[model samples]
Target: MRPVPLVLPLAGLPHRVPGDTDAVVVGGGVAGISAAVVLAERGVRVTMVEAADTLGGRLGAWPHTLPDGTRQIVEHGFHAFFRQYYTWRAILRRADPALGFLRPVVGYPVISRRWPDEDLTGLPAAPPLSLLALFVRSPSLGLRDITGADRSLALELLGYHRERSTPALDAMPAGKFLDRFGITERARSMLFEAFARSFFCDPDALSAAELVAMFHFYFLGNPEGLGFDAPDTDYLSCIWTPLADHLTRHGGRIRAGAAADTVEPADDHRWRVRVAGGAQVTARHLVLALDPAGLRGLAERSPGLRRVGPALAERAAGLRVAPPFAVSRLWLDRDVAPGRATFSAVTGEPTLDSVTCYHRLEEPSRRWAATTGGSVLELHSYACVEPDAAQATARMRDELAALWPETRDAVVRHQLCRYEATAPSFPPGAAGARPTVQTDARGVRVAGDFVELPWCAGLMERSAMSGILAANEVLAEEGAAAEPVHGVPQRGLLAGWTPMTRRRR
Candidate 1:
């Protein structure tokens, strides 16, 4: 089942001898780990520092014990790995040649409680056909609904060009854009809103450009269909642990529980990073792969970062963090109906956005369910309106009970709720303000999902892409060829013409 390891073909640059170049990567998330791995593969000495005791920042997991002493690594929420994630898949393939850890979820199902049978499934994979099929088959949409939409904007959906179309779109809010199109309220609630919430932003608050770009990235530009894959087991074991192993095997040092306090240029022109516990790491290059909040914190607290300039600090401070998101996991004393989907997006719920029956989707959960004759379900809420976790969890539990009557009587054996303010906001006109991987500061680079990238991607893919770009910047400075980065194309036939191009005719 294992595939051969694909080697990077860097032209004109011989792999440097090990330990010749040194890099200090701040943060041990996917981006930091990815940067470290690429550098180490090129024979550079990499030192990765993580604030938490374990790797995988927002993606990290912790062990939880069941009543019977069985332990499992519980994560913050469900993470969907789309097939379009080429860069992330490449990194994973290096660690797991077989790519056996991923399990595909058949279709993108959006479920509604008001009409239980109205869930979206089995739509055609290819576009134009996919759009046609969805409109025809969906209970919430109809030919009449399409007729009501803005003729030009509706036609533009099938052929959005990132470069030509997004600049104008970026100036407007998604809600206003949809209003111009006169898109049906049902279509807005069922599809557009769901997608917007996925990014943890309100539809009215998000930029139309971001929505169009994401549509192209997830649908039009994607070679792989809309279906996504999840880990066969917990991410800690299948993902982060394997990546950590790969980094170490490639001569990189991973220092967990090491909180970097300052990163300043030393007299020798090497970057000197000091950790909270007085540990110091000096390297020729420094990659600040921290999250949005982390970056802002470093800019405020680290005097070394101030040396980069007032502009870097100002930019960090200006970056926006999305509203808080929440996740709840419940161990029910009964199984859901066999007909229930493994994963489903929910509508008509105030706080709940999606639900996943882990016992049905994951093998370990299935085995545990078999023994207990019960199920484990994880529910997620993005940009939750609830003021606190207790209220959020209560509302979600009630919604679950109403959706699946079996859960009303089933006893709750164990439950966990988590809330965090981490997602990057993509508000109107925000794209132009996002930071790039390469900075003006010497020996310094930044990597995160929020950073601006040349190609179109979001979430974990964006994180990995930024990391690779940061590493490539350093590689380029050393006169070595940069690594290849992949992206899904966004320019379609109808989208090829911009307002300027059309006006020229």
Candidate 2:
């Protein structure tokens, strides 16, 4: 089956491409590329401008090769998606078949320095079973309370609705969500901790709504794919490189190092986009695919846009993304033990949120898992804990020492990558709160994971989906055949929860 129809309208754009071209998408990440590709496929001449030399903003710098020459195809930070990541899965399936998908027998891993009292070896059949297994095997749960109240709590969460009179949103702290659900401290530390660390934010700092939505999307949905796995190529090769190549192949121009300095509206709503070190490129319609905050300085130069700029700025500012985090790489002298990509390791203060032995997942011959000699071992640390560069770097080194003290001597090489404000907290209302792809003003559009697949929509898939929606809407208004399928206005399964589904334009 095809992906669910997801098209966010980039309506209200004035058609004036000068030539036959339809739109100009700014920012060369997944969003820009997706929009551009979709538009090109639908017979629109599209120009995509990227500020950086490469595409795939956060996704570009990942899948690092190790010292032993073994590659651990890890994300900059640990990020994996569920089966319901329809946009992501569809892209990968089109790109390569070898990146196979797998379903984990367990939900989140329960790890400790010592083996637990109950060994959860047998995989459960479904989510409820898996949750039951987790509660039974986990160390932190209070048996009586969990057995009594937790089931109801889980149901409530899985079936949460904004109109359901649940006061979960008012409880800002994610910790409260766990507490209210009677999740044992062990479950909190093991399962919730890893998920929160995936955000790279503090549990206390995260909104309960965001946490709840994420939990349901990632863990409870699909019965298998949430924490399940399918082999997948790195995000760059599958999404960014292909897009850049596509743009280049189509005679579309992309200038690297050309940061947008200002956006000014011409006499008839045409956009003049001035670049940092290049000539101004004019287009009929312009897309500010950038996170709103990134455009603050540029908006200052244009008249009649100053007022609109700050409001956009507020959307950007108010959007609380996961704080910056450090991705640490370690090159090992010897091969790592073989195993499945793991989210295990229940610890007191979890250093690494989740560990994936990329070598194991992507390569069997590499002879290492998370650790690689001629290989690479990747570790993701919480950004909130280590916000600054110095602290992040030092802490990663310290983490290396702590995890494998003996490996310190055999370390062949190391590298550190830090991504700031990497992903937004995609709670439920956040999607509704997402700024429209079309703004109130003229000659402007927005496209990002934040705009389309707002709930936990960080990966290239969401970006692509958003871009496609934006481009499709723009082209449709220009009298082009709109290939994108919009979401059915009528409610179907689970449509009761989505506000967007209830309303029709």
Candidate 3:
């Protein structure tokens, strides 16, 4: 269950590059920050440009004035900091060496209206045992469901082969895969579908191969248990500001609020990132670490970029953005039931997928609640069908009231709703067409969750791993040693067991 070394340090290699090894990273998300941190620490002159005024992109947090004139930090969305995010935690260590800001979420529950809640916490980390534990303890699943299920599909789920499984199941939808796997409807709704919708994609629109990969990465092959932790404060204070200071401490320059307009070529340097204000950052290496839509737009804007990095531009063009998701943070005039879980993954609702009682989770939110005798609640719809923010917010609120019951009478003093299409989508038959860390482009690498990686990682970890891999590429070109990367167990537990079973028979 130990992490496998995907990238290892080499002998007879220098730790740092020459003093003038310069790089410019576009986008200030995990991907860009990771690349900038690694390069800057290794003596590269790193310049990071972010469109937003803050460092974290999707994970960004900013100050907001409540109706009572209370200043509070509002987050863009909620994210679970899983224990298995090796590279991301390494990068986070630059900000807080001890990572004291994180607090463990006690239980992982998928709550539904039709059946009772299914808790995914305390499951064994390794597969076979974990799989057996789920089958044994889960109220939604039973021995009858196992006996009635498709054995082949069940075996395939157990044996997730990166090289073969993806091509085999890439053409099928996740919904169809679950149906074929013969899991009961109760299990499908409370457990499988709840997990599927977290990618901001409907099960019918998501790829089955992607679903299997996620199952392996998050639950089956993970050495870390199902429990995860979250920041007790805000990202701006605990994560971004400190990490930004860490970057500048090592001679890295950050140009916040500077949007990269065009990526133009330079005769003296490898690339120049031209910002909105006519300021340009020229560097020997470039990491285009933007969201799918942002990267595609930049590629389209800079037609000449096709000449230097045709593959990067083409991959950007083909990358798909997931459906719009919504986050609605409500300042409730009353607190929910005291015994409610701090965070819960919700299912069986058309518009609501998850809800977090921020007052119970974070320090500032707790302070606000304690002073005002109110609660800070955040509702999310990962694959929201509604486009309008207000309408989506209303729907999620109504759904929350239906589930929680106590929220039916609570009045919302203030609410902030946001709907955007920022996450990547993995559609059926869309593998191998996406770009990886090392593009065919000269002196250029792309780092994002949308970009295909060779290893198994979920959302934030995927971004960080890609960023580190991109930095390693730059380090290789500069003749400096590459950073080591770790990954969860690559193959599934039952991968080679089929052959053994046949041989024994």
Q: How close is candidate 3 to the true structure, as a TM-score?
A: 0.98
Candidates 2 and 3 compared: the better one by lDDT is 3
- Off by more than 4 A, model 1: 1-10, 15-19, 116-125, 498-505
* Pairs with backbone N, CA or C atoms under 3 Å apart (clashes), candidate 3: none
Question: How many angstroms is residue 21 displaced in model 3 relative to the true structure, after the best TM-score fit?
Answer: 1.3
Residue 250 displacement (Å), model 2: 4.2
lDDT of 1 by residue, 140-220 (tens): 678777677776666556667666556767878888878887767777777777887888877788888888888767766
**Candidate 2: tens digits of C-alpha lDDT, residues 111-206:** 444334223334353455555565675565547546534554456455544333124363457766677667656556656765665655677666
**Candidate 3 wrong stretches, greater than 4 Å:** 497-505
RMSD values, in order shown: 3.1, 6.0, 2.0
Residue 249 C-alpha lDDT in model 1: 92
Alpha carbon deviation, residue 201, candidate 1 (Å): 1.2
Give model 2's clash tally: 21
- In order of lDDT, best first, we have 3, 1, 2
Looking at candidate 1, the ten consecutive residues that score lowest on lDDT are 1-10
Model 3: per-residue lDDT, tens digit, 92-156? 99999999999999898898778888889999888889989999999888888766777877777
